[model samples]
Every structure is written in C-alpha cells, then in structure tokens.
Target: DAARQARYSFLWESAERMSCNRLATGHHRDDQAETVLMRLLCGSTLLGLGGIRPVDDSGRLIRPLLELSRKELEAFARCNHIPYAEDSSNLSEKYLRNRLRHKLIPEIERKYDPAFTRNLILLGEEAAFFRQCLEDRFRQLRDSLVEWAEGDSPRINCPAAAELPLVLRRYLLRRIVFDYTAGGVILSGRVLDAVDRLLVRGTSGRRLDLPGGLVACREFDFLSIGEKKSAPTGAQPEQIEIKGPGKTTIILGGLRWELSFEVRPYEAGTNNVFFQKEGAEGVWEERFDRDKLKFPLYAGAWRAGERIQPFGLEGTKKLKKLFLEKRIPCSMRMRIPVLRDSRGEVLWVCGVARSALGALSPESTSVLLVRALCLPVRGFTGVTIIDT
Candidate 1:
C-alpha cells in the first residue's frame, strides 16, 4: 500500500508535471540520529550505524535536512516569520521520536551545554564525513582486492583481503552484504562473525544464509556473496582458449575482467585462503621460480555439461550436480567462471575449486599463478570476473 501510494504520488508530482525531479522532505538530524539510536538498540547491522541514506537509489526522495537540526529549523522559521502548521499531536507520547524530541532533548540541552543541539548536529556532520572517508577507503580496497561476479554479489580473495587493515576489511565486508531493512530481521553478530570466519579460514562448501535471502559461500580461496541463486543463467560453462602466459579480458553485465599469469614454485596442496574482509591480515605474496610454471593457462565462464573432481569428493562429478548438491540454483550456475590450461584441463572454477592438476606441489618445476581482476563499469551493477 505504501509503495502504491508512493508510486501514485511520484506520477502525480513527476518532473513532467511539476518541473521537479522529486518531492523533497525535511527530516532533521535529531530524527535521523534518533533512528540510528533506535536501530542500534534494536540490533541493526553494521551498515545501519551510519543512519539513513542521504540519497536513495531512485535519485529521488532525497533527505535535504540530513544536516539540519530541529532547533535550527524552528529558529529559521521564526526568524523568517515562515508560517507552518504545527501538529499538536506531536506532544503525544505514543511515538518514541516525538517523545525524545519533546521530553528528552530539551532536558538534555538544559542539563548539558546550551549548545547541545548545535553540537550534536555538528557531530553528526563530522560523523558523516568520517563515514565517507571509511567508505572511500573501502572502495579503494574493493577496487584492488574484491571482484563482483555477474550478479549483484561480491567475491573476495580471502588471503589477499585478510592482509588489509582491520577497519577497511570490516567496512568492505559489511558494505558488500549490506541490506536496507530498517525494520526487518537482521543477521546477528554471531552469524556475521561465522561468515567472516568461514571466509577467512573455513574449508570450501560452507555456506551461511543471511536475512533478505542473501547467501554467503566459501569456495576455493574466495568468498562469494549474493542472493540464493538457482541455476547458471548465461552460456553454459565452456572451455575457453587462453593464449597462455599473458593477460586476457572477458565481459559480463557490462563489466570487464582481466586474467594474468606468472610462473613460480608450487605448494603441496591448495594455498586455498579465506581472508576476512576486515583488518590487514590476509595480504601476502607467494612465489614460484619462473621456470617452474606451465605456459598458456586458460580462463573463462564455466560451460554447461562440464565436470570436476571437486576437492575431497570421490570420482568425477558433473558441475551441475555439484552445484545442485551445494544448493546453487540455475540462475547462479550461469555466472560461475572456469579456468583451464592448453589441454582443456580445468584449473580454477571461480568461487568453487582449483583442479588438483593445477594444485601447486613442492616438486613442481614452475608454478602457474593466475590473477583475476574485474574491469570498472558505469554504475552499481552486480559481480563480474576476469582472469589473465
């Protein structure tokens, strides 16, 4: 009903009719701060700590008063002799925000500094700036360390991300899985920590179901984040030819990805890493002598009718069956990427597995290191992968 009302209101007041992009509202900082405090008390997610969004997704419904205080607004109204309707119902104790405003805030101002409201407003502004800086840092780290697959999900190289500073890691992790539910059931701190641990250290095939139907999965050395996907959507996973030993690019959902390769000594087993999205703990450099690696590693989307000897599983299994067993549906199966070598042997399946054949061993003369990178796109689209 609210959505329907909003839609009607938008259509009635649309730019075509009113010459305005949106109908703006005045929601003061006290209102926003009250919201944050209430949500925190009620157990909102980490991202909720920042309070309401300044700009909503649709580019309309902007909060122009995010930086204003009720007192200042009232003062402005008085100074300008701006007549406005005052709801006497505001004195009612039925609403918490109203109660806080009428009862608590005034008392706080008297008991504390006379400039309490002004100071709080300034504090909120400063906090917003700090949040921007944190978000900026997180984006910078995300650009270098994380990859969004075809869907609006995120993939992080556990080992590489773990090496980042704790703050950036947490911010990235929280932002990747952020939900805009102000009054819905949210994931608990325990579940978030469990997901983090699963990414940073747990074995592959582990999964966590968060609120809003979101799912977190641990595969190979990357953490996959997204809605509970059903089947692989696009072209079936197929063998793609990589001209070996050089960078390559692939495009999905308007995002470009790059794949690069190098040679070095190999480890006995998977250097399978899961780094938390917080704190600089996962960053590290492993190397192999250049002479030890095989040339011309292959990389591309997983094709239909492909199979893999998934980690500990016995014998070979169809990739489709594996995804089914893992509860991955058809939609997601479409986007899972696959990497291979010249002989058509699969090497790495994005967020899934690195073939035993490609597993680095101590005796390996050269190690083939594949680096996956995502090229930038215009806006907030979902995840995409590229390997070079």
Candidate 2:
C-alpha cells in the first residue's frame, strides 16, 4: 500500500512538475480484471470491485489503455517496430498481482472457465456503472451534509445522514474514509461495522482511531474526521510564541487546525478588576489579569502530569483529570493547546480549562487576546479567544 501511494504520488508530482494536466497509464483490459480480482480477494465494497478507473476522481489520472488488452498492445508495438521492455518486477511472484497474473488466474482459466477474465471485466463494468449513478447522489449528500474541517478533514451531520438509505449511509461514510486515505487503506468489513456502531452510540467527543492514521470523532450530532494528531516520535513538539500584539498563525506538525493569536485593547466591558467571557455556547474566550502574565507566552501540546488551577476551582487539578471530567477523549488530550507564560507557568489549556492565576479584573484595560478559528465540516466554526 505504501509503495503504491508513493508511486502514484511520484507520478502525480512529476506530472505537475512537467506542467501536465493529464497523467496517463497503460492499464489494459486484463489489468482491470486483475484489479477486480485483487480487491475481491482483499474484501471490498461495490465501488472497489469496480476495478481501475478510466479517469480517477482527481481527473488527473487517466488509463487510456483500459479498453485494450495487454496482448493487443504488445501486438501493436511489434507491428510498429516499437521496442519496449517489461519490468522485471512483473514476473516476480512475490507480489500478489504477479501471482494472480502468472499462476492463480491461469489455473482458474484451465479448470473453471476459459472466459473467466472476460466475465470479471463485465462485472467490473456493471459495478462501475452503478457506482457512477451512486456517485452523483453521494456528491449531493456530501455538499449538503458533510462539512470540511481544517486540513480537509470531513465532518458529517449524523441526523441528516440518518435520513439516507442504509446502503447509501454506509457508502457515503466509506467513501469519505477511502478518499481521505487516497486508497492507502481500505476499511475491512469489521472496521466499517465499528464505524457504524460508533455513529449510533458513541458519545460526543468520542473518537475511534482508524486505519491509515486517520481518526473518526463524534461530536454531538456530527461525525468529525481528521488526521490522527501525532508529532514525530522524538521530535521536539512545535511551540508557537505569541509576542504580544498583531495576528499570527502557526501550523503544528501533524495538526490540521491553524492556531491564531492576537492581542488588543478591551474596548468595551464592565469596569471590573478581572473579566472573562465564556458560556454554554458561542466562541470560547479566556481573559487574564494583564500584570499576572509575562510576555512572549508559549503554546504547545499538553504535557503529561501538567496541573492547572482551574478557574473557580479550589486547588490545582491535573489536566488529565480535567479532560476526563469534560469527556474529552484520551486520543485527543495530547493535542490540546497548553499555554504557558514566559516563566513556564501554564496559564490556560485551550478548549478545556483556564487557570485562576491570570484571572482577569477590569474590562476597560487592554488585554492580550489570542483567537483560534477552525472550520468544522458540518457548517460550524470553532473559535477561541484569549485575552490579557
């Protein structure tokens, strides 16, 4: 799977580098049948059993030779005196494709049916026709129901999807995963079943780790999909420093949501020593006493064993415990933004908790305001405001 992704990526990149709009491959009629058989053996949906596409979803990958058999291509080359060499890998049985081509397929033809390959092609054609029809409806559903969150992750509307037919519900979900992984991973039946279960019963903020390093999150009536957040194994996790003022955007490694920061005067507010804006809905906001915070504050992934004096709480509480209280999935705890002062004192944990240390006072005085904007796939914006 890795090799195929790399090869296609290389081909796509090479084509782009050459300023080519279309990248064609010689995937012949026999090859299409083999693809169908390969996917069948590996377990696939109606879409996968359709075999190689003449033009893939991106429309950049074109297999012009799909209608012509490999033998026909070879005969044409010989007639034209065009010299061509086959890759040595094509003869190696180490690959499943080659094994099918040289052994399994031949045996099936010898004993079971001579026209087996042709039948497979016909089946693929039928499947492809049905798939195209479904694809049209799927697009309409996606446009109206699926929201594209940060980094192109899809967030689905569960209530809306429940209205679709069962076959289409599964198909839509599967296609989201398939297209997101770029075919690097195909969810097995068991995995697909698990996704269905999650959709029906999973609690909000629940996440199920998926194949190909993607994750499925259930937030209320929405199903959020995004790359599994993970920094490199041993790399120093990226830390973005907000030097008070102006807007700044930082992209953390493997994290899709862009963190934005800004600091400005508190134009209108009740003249109170400490002021904070947060509620059961709307954007997340945190305000702190300007004098309590040090400049050049840093933000990074939450650290293990970190504790915070949660606002309105009696004493410091471990961030882990706080996460549990809020029903934040363990899978996402590590990626929550942990904001620290210049002295390395954690002042706030974005999306989860805020400390009482910088507890804001007067609303008139200027304060640091850091805002985060993440567009959820289901027609919502995740916004966070941090003020001095």
Per-model TM-score on C-alpha atoms: 0.52, 0.55
Please report, as a residue range, the 10-residue window in candidate 2 with the lowest summed lDDT. 272-281
Candidate 1 residue lDDT tens string, 215-312: 77877677887667565456544435666566667654354556566654455664533212113111112233345335555566666677776554
Candidate 1 Cα misplacement greater than 4 A, ranges:
1-16, 29-72, 75-81, 150-153, 178-190, 229-388
The residue-level lDDT of candidate 2 at 141 comes to: 82
Regions of model 2 farther than 4 Å from truth? 1-22, 148-153, 178-186, 212-214, 227-388
lDDT of 1: 0.61
- Backbone clashes, each candidate: 53, 12
Clashes of 2: 12
Q: Candidate 2: global Cα-lDDT?
A: 0.73
